[model samples]
Target: MSEVRLYSKADFSECRLTNHPLYSYIQVFFSQELSELVENSTNGTCYALEVGQKLCLVVVAQFQEGQTYPTSLRAQYLDYAQEELALTGIKGKRLLSGAFQLLKRIVPKTIDEVVYVGNYLLSTNLFQPFTTEELQKIEALLQRRFPTKTIVYRSQNSCLNQQLMENLSALNYQSFISRQVFIAHQSQVIQQKKTFKKDRKLAKDTTFNIRTNFDVTNYSERIIELYTQLYISKYSQINPRYTPAFIEAMKTVQNTSFTGVFDEENLIGVTMSWELDGTLTVPILGYDLSYPKESGIYRLLTYYTLLRVNDEQLFHMSSGVGPFKLSRGAEYFPEYIYYKRPASAKERRLSFWLLQKVNTILTRMSNKRAY
Candidate 1:
């Protein structure tokens, strides 16, 4: 077991989580400057797990109150709550479940809440497996530190952390299948290059140009604008509303790139991606809605992204949009959300029931979409 210690604001810069390549995004999220931006909503705190004074693991936690769940979670409890309100008899059980879900979403001051952990902006797998005993100790340490709050360890990932999964199950944490991710096998996409010739030709036919950014200042506003028009304005409920501050923070992360598609200088599309362990992943994507869909702009962007993988000889390109990714030869990966509310028996029971109902509602929704 390692000794876990919390870093105070003064010495927080020393926490190694900030520089770890595997968790650079985590580092950016918990960065002093960015943390200040989100402080009103969440109190960002960092902890180091050290074995014999050598840092072994680092976890950044956000103590949030009256805050909704992390944006990574796509499930909308409000809609389910509204639907549940309209049901009756056996179906009315959804209403009970919805009520609890709603309550959990807008946690009041009574039970201090740590609603989620991990990257809030997208589905990320940063946590290394921790033993059951270590997890138990971590939970106890978190409880003691935030005595008032009922910490709910929230994790969303396409790939399962087997040990964490086992430990959560052993500890009686409720689990829910939140969503799915799409992975495009590089060899598969490359082998089918003949099929993409039309797309490549279309992209070349148009005078549109694509560019990548390390310092995003020049197009940050436009990126946010297009992102807002396509995602925030269109899908505010489910989208992760990234601000310019977040875009600016990307400047500090070494492994990330912001690629933009422009038509004679107008920024029409943007994709924020990270390359790690030979996998290129796109976490944020947006495009101008006013652009003529007939221009084949989005498809062009996809083609260019595939080129990135082909050029790098990377394994695969992982993206979102499950159906679209599948249509484009990308395989699907199931993503799950593991949550545990271990404060009291009542809280645990509510959470368990809520998890079941949420899963049911979400599965039904997914099936309808897939069908």
Candidate 2:
């Protein structure tokens, strides 16, 4: 087995290479310069397995402690919990909170720690081809490296690595379905949906200028304000929080581009996307929620994205709306967060059992509602 070594903040530069064609996105994040840019947020540690000086496998993990969950994960959990409680009366809310307390009892408070492998916000992880034995060896190394904390790997857009998945399963990693990502590809063949048609009609009447580059620093304050209004106040359960500092940092990221939707001098909407390897990944979309839905900004943006796809002849386009993507002739993949802990860890074992029990109850309730 190849030796696996841990690299500190200073040694991440060793992993940076010219290009691997298939893994440019992975390469960009693993580079020392980019890693330093994100260090304040990610707090990551890099690891690599080498075979005779050749890098065979690499893993980057973020260390998180109590109340130190990433801004995105904490926001999603709190928002979703609050949204669910809103439907119930005071008594129901109390009961649900009690249920959460019971769950917390099963999990050790000291172990609310996790090491997230991959892009903590976007759920993308990369690994070079390695044998099953090598994968197992890497897993063991991770366990030894972080003996007290749980390890999590998030896979999104159905980009699953067979070898890594198998190795994780062999090590008894438990999986939980998170959400879905919507991807539109080869969209020139897609038939326009009702939303598309409605937006086309509205676009003729509404005049908004779309530009690829606008002064991010000048509008940085307003951009964060609008983003909070739309994301936090409105769609509260969404993952990822775009603070002014984070957005400003993202503007400097090499692969990303910023697009502004303007009504004369006023900025109405904005999107930040990455164009990588024939794929366009839109990570942020902030807009004026006061605008009437009939104004068709949502559909107009979708239309604009597909237009770019057709013009560039790109292979993939990813949007945040999962259900609407299907209507736009796109495929949706359910995302998952996989977790692993030492087999002897009591908290992990009990939590897994509780999860299975809760899943069964939820399934029964869903089936009854359907009938």
Candidate 3:
């Protein structure tokens, strides 16, 4: 059996290359810079198993050491830190998060502590193939590792929709966070829904032409401009992820990517995403609402994304944060979070307190009112 070996940096860089799926990891997200970053990374460890020398899964802690370093890393520094870390894979839900897991084996307070941590924004295909049953199995594994009344799984992008939430609830995972996802699924009766007829009168006024995967220069500023406009508008429940600067920096990212509806001379709306590693991630969307009735652009964008990308292993349209998705025909799936405990009681207590602080900081970070 080929062991899933943890290759060091020299090995990672020196390995002879081939036309492997792993090479996909090196593209936009896991650039040489990001790969090299793993060396001095205190927050996390990166691991990969050579799959026939062509495929190497992008694996690492979506986080760094904050007393949560893996047992391996902790053992190396145990005399000084007395920490433990363990790795896990995505049992269900988000791609990057569920793909693999990592944690400190030791906890504070009691041996009762448990941790099943998931991080959003990993490579799109990290969960290459996933299922709900496998997720339940992960929960079962945590049960054997650590017993607990509480588990926490956090998600961004608001991609998990209501039906999925119901399924999870049937399985005992409830929505404890404000984040949400939207879906638009087509069914037998609804399959015959009326066609969206373009108003010829408004068509003349609408000059926006939609395109895929273009350089940010043509529409970067304008896209961000619409985002800023949205920031001022009250429609968006939370528009706290991107700053104009971050949006600008994204352009430098390879596969400078997004789907946009441009109005002749102006950029009317754009749905910006990143092809990180091999996964597609939704960072944000900015649309000119001035043409809600006339634009019909968001609808068009969704249709094309489904028509083109849906066949290639189904794209994650994200959570039900927008009403538009429900009308368009997207299906929602449940995303979950699980937490298992450390063997040590002392570490469990420490983990609890640290988690409290971390959640607070994260919540505030997402709240633009304070920004």
lDDT (C-alpha) at residue 347 in model 2: 56
User: Candidate 3: where are CA atoms >4 Å away?
Assistant: 6-11, 15-22, 25-126, 130-191, 195-205, 221-257, 272-284, 288-294, 309-313, 344-371
Candidate 2 structure quality by residue, lDDT tens digits, 22-140: 23343344454433433224434444444323342233333243221232333223334445445434344565556555665564443435555544344233334445566566567
Q: After superposition, how far is residue 153 of candidate 2 from its true place, in Å?
A: 0.8
- Evaluated against the true structure, the overall lDDT of model 2 is 0.54
Model 1 weakest lDDT span, ten residues long = 66-75
| After superposition, candidate 1 runs with Cα above 4 Å error | 1-3, 16-19, 22-27, 30-68, 71-76, 79-112, 123-126, 148-163, 189-197, 213-215, 276-279, 308-320, 348-355, 361-371
Residue 332 error, candidate 1, Å: 2.5
Model 2 worst lDDT run, 10 consecutive residues: 66-75
Regions of candidate 2 where Cα sits further than 4 Å from its true position: 1-6, 18-101, 123-134, 157-167, 189-191, 200-205, 237-239, 275-278, 308-322, 348-350, 359-371
What total of clashing residue pairs does each candidate reach?
1, 0, 51
**Best-performing candidate as measured by lDDT:** 1
Ranking by lDDT: 1, 2, 3
CA error at residue 184 for candidate 3, angstroms = 5.4
- Evaluate all candidate structures by whole-model CA lDDT and list the values in order: 0.55, 0.54, 0.40
lDDT tens digits, residue span 1-371, model 1 = 56555544456466665445544455555564433433223433444343223332233334333332342121334432333234323344655565655755753333334434433444343444556776676667766766544444444344435577778789776666554555565655654765477777787788878777434877777877877786556744334455677777775676777777888778888888766545666656779888788887678767777776554434233323445555665665545656555455244456546557666865665444431
